[model samples]
Target: MPPRIPVSEAQIDRVVAQFYQRVRAHPALGPVFAGHVADWPVHEEKIGRFWRNALLVQRCYDGNPMQVHRAAGDVKAQHFPVWLSIFDAVLAEELPQHLAQAWSALAHRIGRGLSFGLPQTDDADPVPYLG
Candidate 1:
């Protein structure tokens, strides 16, 4: 079993960048993100901080992701699957198998956190991947 992969801010930023590269080209989520993440770099930094803090317990940033996801009403339940899939693809392609699994679990957790309107830190079902 893959011991939990250690995640850092830089890693989170890389993952977010890779994920968005694909997401921006996606028909379902691209336009939506494009409309808002105009300052893509800034958005990346913000999100990097969000994930770093949320997943790794780093005190880097603060933002209610649940509210953001809720506001992203366009980001339906199906989107979570796509997100996880893309995330899995990215990690598996870039990181080792062990790291990939760890990242997948975390990504799925993030999805479930949003799916049920709770942070991934709280209890919830594991997320499944699909990208």
Candidate 2:
């Protein structure tokens, strides 16, 4: 195994920012996310904590992600697989393999652990282009 790269808060912030931007800009998902997010800065902070806790063995997060996604109502179950795929892509270039596997596993776990109403077949995770 490769040495575990120490991920900083800033790096996680950048990843979440990039991911959220792709989600917001996605044609299928853009409108669904509009106005629903309410506070980007706050969400950014929350995601920073989320990623930190997610990568580490800490359990600082008090709430459940399934509930958050359920409330988001913008994303459905099918969207998760693609989201995982896209997220892995981001990690593939930026994060190391172990980190990539960890993130991907988290996404997969989230996908299996949650479900929404009848999913729309057309909705898919947007391809992230961090340009």
Highest TM-score against the true fold, candidate: 1
TM-score of 2: 0.70
The local distance difference test score of each candidate is 0.74, 0.67
Question: Backbone clashes in each candidate structure, one number apiece?
Answer: 1, 0
Per-residue lDDT tens digits for candidate 1, residues 1-131, read: 22235765567777889988998898877887876677988888898877777667777787888788777645566667777888789888777787678778877887887777633332254676676
lDDT for residue 89 in candidate 1, whole number 0-100:
90
Query: What is the TM-score (0 to 1) of candidate 1?
Result: 0.77
What TM-scores do the predictions have?
0.77, 0.70
Cα deviation of 84 in candidate 1 (Å)?
A: 1.0
List RMSD in Å for every model shown. Answer: 8.8, 9.2
In model 2, the clashing pairs are none
User: Against the true structure, candidate 1 has what lDDT?
Assistant: 0.74
